[model samples]
Target: MIWQGRSRRKPTGGLYRPHRKKRKYEMGRPQTETLIGERKIKLERVRGGNYKVKLVRDKYANVYVPSEGKVVRVEIKRVVENPAHVHYARRNVITKGAIIETEIGLARVTNRPSQEGLINAVLIEQK
Candidate 1:
């Protein structure tokens, strides 16, 4: 069909286009991660983005990272690595964790494990 004054061609210009909304998920609201123990950490809201957590506590006091049986309250210790591994450093000396302390307690964690279905390390905290 032909028009009188205006053409039937779609406008190829400046008006803002509205977004389409869809209800696809079977469940309710989206799930989010819950941080236990320390809630001080604030990470980036966007997924896949990197976050760097720094110590805000007094410099005089130190953090304690457990080792073997005893805990090492080194002057300069922080969560240098994510989730499992942590790095502790003082002066120019740096030592990676053979064992580490988590929100629950101390445990020996690694990226990979040996043996089939066999995992190492458990919480060292007392009952």
Candidate 2:
């Protein structure tokens, strides 16, 4: 009876889940390399949950964490595509969380749409 209904089954094509164990550890690791001497931090994505990256090499993708408390210095690693996003040439940092207070502006985290190290998270300021 199980085999009969199997034919009508449909695929969701949501996440790419591998059947067997991964050759190496997947979670909490950056898919790509960061700048020569930058420290990458693990970021939390809304969907997948967590990912990792650096703060120097790709400032656009790294900094800009959810503002936990008052305004402070936050490094940016990835730049997103939205009104919150700024030009790569002129703009640099972003204020995560709290609806972006200062004119400092905001940038969206580069969802790993292209490169390897990319995750839905941003390498924001630690403080």
Candidate 3:
């Protein structure tokens, strides 16, 4: 489990008195690493009686081309850039705001792949 609460120690390294117990809202979930591969999804039961679809591996992305005025499914070739992290881009880790190369062209990811179990991107104009 991940810790989402403030530390008991102060900035000066002095112990501080506890005011309250940990709450559900302060809970943290594990990091879901979505990778480029065959399509795969994992279901997670979240708080408030809701379920979330986590994409473990995705091969296709729904790319929206402005010129076409419609969305098209394209095979993901590789990750081009990831604003989240450079390492993630090199690792081909799919995440929100990641730029990926597809059969159609380069597209910027607009959705959270791990949380939505789907990759949605908007095509970028090539120079």
The TM-score that candidate 3 achieves is 0.86
State the lDDT of candidate 1 residue by residue for 1-127, as single tens digits.
3232333344775554434443343223332221112223323233256443321121111233344543332222222223322322211111222243444444443312211111133334565
lDDT of 2 by residue, 1-42 (tens): 123112333376455544565443343333332331254454
For each candidate, give its TM-score against the true structure. Answer: 0.19, 0.18, 0.86
TM-score of 2: 0.18
Per-model lDDT:
0.30, 0.36, 0.91
Sort by lDDT, top down from the best: 3, 2, 1
Best by lDDT: 3
The stretch of ten residues in a row with the least summed lDDT in candidate 2 is 94-103
Candidate 2 residue 45 C-alpha distance from true site, Å = 22
Given candidate 1, what's the lDDT at residue 110? Answer: 31
Candidate 3 lDDT (Cα, whole model)?
A: 0.91
Q: Tens digits of per-residue lDDT for model 3 on 1-127?
A: 4466667799999999988887877777887889999888999988887999999998999999998799999999999989888799889998899999999889999999899989999999765
RMSD of 2: 15.1
lDDT of 3 at 93: 96
